[model samples]
Target: MNRFLVLPLALPMVALAAEPAGQATTPLAGSDMAGQLGQLLLGLLLVIGLIFLLAWLLRRVQQLAPRGGQVIKLLASQSLGPRDRLVLVQVGNEQILLGLSAGRITPLHVLKEPVHLADAEPATPEFAQRLMELLGKDQKDKS
Candidate 1:
């Protein structure tokens, strides 16, 4: 009676432990690695996105931060020709007009009374303005 009951319980255990014939009992290692490849790419993209976000935030903060101890501030500017321009700069309480060309800068005059101008965007730098003008001229020539 003990032998009969033991065989019945042991038979099911043996069958459960046995793998089906002519088939893999475990998954391929390459397939497992391939599945993780997607996760790796996603993580890489997330890190790159985080870097870009931080860079953008840094730029924004720099724009909003106070610029202290600036000795000279550009108050006004006007282009004389292509390469020459007049720049008015504030140093302490005095405003001086300066002449800027390709190779040199000259102090033209020192104002007795400081000229006050409205708060506005400073004049675009020379290189950018010249580039745009050149591009515009090319287009005009083509037309």
Candidate 2:
């Protein structure tokens, strides 16, 4: 078993060593501007792909983030008492309560809002659709 494993691994190294010692190891033969530019473009493409992937993942995480008033209510009740200090934030139509106590902080509940999500600047469906389009364009460009 040891010989079988060792032989396979050793064979590649043996084959690599068989190449002439003085031969150059540059990826493409003939040093030219276009080849270097092509390599640079490939590297740039890889970086852009990684950035898009991260943005896509971030959007997914944001989409999956918790919503509704109940979760806020539970957190608030668990983390705050009657005398605790609290900050209420209202964005568009959503409200979040932040509780502050001596050496501790917690979320209290989501307050009722006068405004609704429908009035927000960027609607969820549009944002998701645009994100998908951008990702699709990126994939098409890659191909």
Candidate 3:
């Protein structure tokens, strides 16, 4: 009776140990490892490509959106001092000149007739150009 009980348990253990001699027990073969690595790289590249595609689409959509017909338009701005500015803004048909200091905005004037602005050319020079002209005038005066 002892011999019969031991044989029953030993038979299952022997079967579990008996693996086929031709097959490998480990699953990581060279081809399998290469294929898995390829799949991982492809997935990473797809996620990166999708992010760039979404960003490009967002930029295109923003460009297509309407930008005209705004109520307030900045016609021109000039730096009055280090921390002060004079701004000309057009609100609908009325043109307003505003003085902007460090902490306050004062309305300087409102034009009864809107200034006729040329379509292609601006009346005022750029800040950099104006600054260069002032510097040149100062050098000439010193000479």
Question: Model 2 scores what on Cα lDDT?
Answer: 0.67
For model 3, the superposed segments whose C-alpha errors exceed 4 Å read 1-48, 122-143
Clashing pairs in 1: none
Q: Model 2 TM-score?
A: 0.31
lDDT of 2 by residue, 1-143 (tens): 89999998999998788775535556445666688989999999999999999999998998887765433222112324666666554654567776778787676776674323443333224577889989999999999
Which ten contiguous residues of candidate 1 have the minimum total lDDT?
Answer: 18-27
Query: How many residue pairs clash in model 3?
Result: 0
Task: Answer with 1 or 2, whichever has the higher TM-score.
Answer: 1
Residue pairs in candidate 2 whose N, alpha carbon or C atoms collide under 3 angstroms = 72-109, 76-108
**Candidate 1 C-alpha lDDT tens digits along 71-122:** 8888888999999999999999999999999999999999999998866555
Summed backbone clashes in each candidate are 0, 2, 0
